[model samples]
Target: MAKTVNIEDAVSYFDTEVLHSGAWDEADDALRQKALNNAERILYRTYGKTYDIDDSSKWMPEEAVYEQALWMLRQDDAVQKTELGQVGVSVSGISVQMAGKPQYIAPEARRIIAEDGGSSPRSKWTVI
Candidate 1:
């Protein structure tokens, strides 16, 4: 199966060098590919396979590809950070303001997917 997005594309989209090293590292490449696969799966599950048709006449939009890649990188980063045990620890005497929440699929990505004309109708009525 053709990957909707690749590690290089993801690195470019994120404007970071972290993922670039994954291209040469075996373990890192696996993890990066897994993230990309998960992102593509989410898009297919949410919007249907037709949304990513790969025919010569019609191809997936560049914006959609970028959005999906961004979401994929976000998920990968969240997983790595969580695995490294970087989560905040709160104390009773000290107050701390939490930073931005981690998201699997960003709102902009969701909006793009929802607007792709692949979403099912909210209701179906039957009359006898």
Candidate 2:
């Protein structure tokens, strides 16, 4: 079964739990829906497959999904960054170092995923 997180829940999460830019409130229904959809896809692709479906916490947390959705709305290039997952870049003698991994998952969300045992199998060699 595909798990879906409601946008209203995410909105409420931001409204009460997180300090945010209020972009979710400003966005139209379609755009908010798109952001939520993208957030879900990223979370599932990164962590869902490894979850034990029978576990009580099988579904991704609402707060995590909300964080990802807000991040997507705030950072337009989030999808590309998540895809790249690269650390640093240098162009024409200009070097730039990213603060952390490029995956679009928010830090708090990542922590939640880890705590919930939602991480995929991986070895040290894996960059993402």
Candidate 3:
């Protein structure tokens, strides 16, 4: 579930909205993983009728998936801005999310990675 956020305080602060501030995202990675695991289970059992058991947890809007991928890629220290400009970070040095399924990765990540300048690849999008 791309709805996973690292911050708990933020989770409470926001409208429980998919897109929220980063402050609530302070939870440890282990905790985050546990939450995501639970989310998948919940989704599979709760919304099985809406989405196949295999796909319920897997279902995500393209924009959210793209945002998630971008977040993961930026976590790597290698990503950088083009010519130290305001433009988004470059994917040339960034790495993909760890042990993540292909569904979680979005086409937009590659698009942002390939951009040359102007907009911020990382700052523009959100978890929502």
**What is the C-alpha local distance difference test score of each model?**
0.53, 0.70, 0.38
User: Per-residue lDDT for 79-116 in model 3, tens only?
Assistant: 33222333344478974433322232234433432342
User: Candidate 2, clashing residue pairs?
Assistant: none
lDDT of 1 at 60: 41
Q: What is the alpha-carbon lDDT of model 1 when measured against the actual structure?
A: 0.53
lDDT, residue 17, candidate 2: 80
Ranking by lDDT: 2, 1, 3
* Tens digits of per-residue lDDT for model 2, 1-128: 22567767767777788766488878997898898888877777677576533454666777677777877787755345545776566789997666655555777778777787666434347577
Give candidate 3 regions above 4 Å deviation. 1-19, 22-24, 55-128
TM-score against native, each model: 0.45, 0.66, 0.29
Better of 1 and 3 by TM-score: 1
lDDT of 1 by residue, 16-91 (tens): 4334433323336566667566666665555554464445333344345556545555455445565565565457
Choose 1 or 3, whichever is better by lDDT: 1
49, model 3: CA deviation in Å?
Answer: 0.8
* Highest TM-score against the true fold, candidate: 2
Distance from true location, Cα of 66 in model 2, Å: 1.0
